[model samples]
Target: MQKKVNLASAGISAEESQLFRESITGAKPIAQDKIPPVVAPRKLKRRTDVLAKALDDNLFYFSDEFEGYIAEGVSLSWTKSGDDPHLTGRLRRGEFQPQVILDLHGMTTREAKAELAGLLAYCAKQHINCACVVHGKGLGILAKKVPNWLIQHPNVRAFHTAPKTWGKHGALLLLLSVED
Candidate 1:
């Protein structure tokens, strides 16, 4: 008892009406043999603007946790994600012995920088546990620069003031990350 309805008279285009019929009744068995209609794809606008001010800003500045200062004479310690809780304590108690000693005493800043980078890379590769960097007690460039440089490196797990026998504030005990 359904009444006949003229969709075209109601303002639907022929193509729209055909689409509606296909939606309601599905495709006819004979029409399954025919190819689908060629529809032009909708044009999408590409996003050009970026939220980051610079590339480094996106990579390093994402952390909400304060990357605290590493002042001269103050012990610097940092544990990367998943390090054991007692590791820093063991380092503090002079338990993890320094496997390698790097003395930055008289070298120029440029020379010290290169040596530090090379030594750290070597330590990470060889899986060295502890290393001591002797930067001397005098208010020299190495005392300030060494701590700052170590803080920035990705492989440095933690560093602290060495025990009295190991040079006190003149040296720093470093815990290197072991490769998986």
Candidate 2:
């Protein structure tokens, strides 16, 4: 019992009505005009627990027996045993530019350890070979501890106290072994 409607009465001209009909001549009727809903993919979360566990087990232990003595105003430099001896020299010469810099100013030993682990993890993930760590020269606490912590990490191939332009005694240029 639908009421009959006229195109002319609806204000459509005959030429326009004819053109519309011609345009849709081969079209089939749609049973449903509703669009389907889209579902977004889930994002993956990083496993900080595993990373923390590894850091705790490997990086936190600093042996008092192992003496890494550094006199005030002296630049620090070290290279892993069996690595190229020239690597330390190259680091000292400032051949490698730091891709990232970590400032550990005013951070406690615990906080610095956590931040250092995070930075190393990030550098490994990003395949960064060079990094600068600024531990400042206030009390020389971090200045001493930073080297000990770095020596523990296997990724650290070599490290040299930054050049005069780069923080000198207050910062270190690290050469990391990044897996390709």
Q: Estimate each model's TM-score.
A: 0.56, 0.65
Residue 107 miss distance in model 1 (angstroms): 1.1
* Candidate 1 per-residue lDDT over residues 1-180, each given as its tens digit: 999778778888989988887898955565465778999999986543542233333234222233454563366555555767666667878998998999888888766766677678678778897899898867656876776677677777888778877887788899987887
Model 1, TM vs. native: 0.56
Worst 10 residues of 2 by lDDT: 58-67
Write down the TM-score for model 2.
0.65
List runs of model 1 lying over 4 Å from the truth.
Answer: 1-68, 72-74, 81-86
Candidate 2's residue-wise lDDT over 1-180, tens digit each?
999779879999989988998999889977996878887988898899997787775555445345564544487888898898888688888899999999999899878878888889889989999999999999988888888878877899999989877798899999999999
Please give the lDDT score at residue 160 for candidate 1.
Answer: 76
Q: Cα RMSD (Å) per model?
A: 16.6, 11.4
* Root mean square deviation (Cα) for candidate 2: 11.4
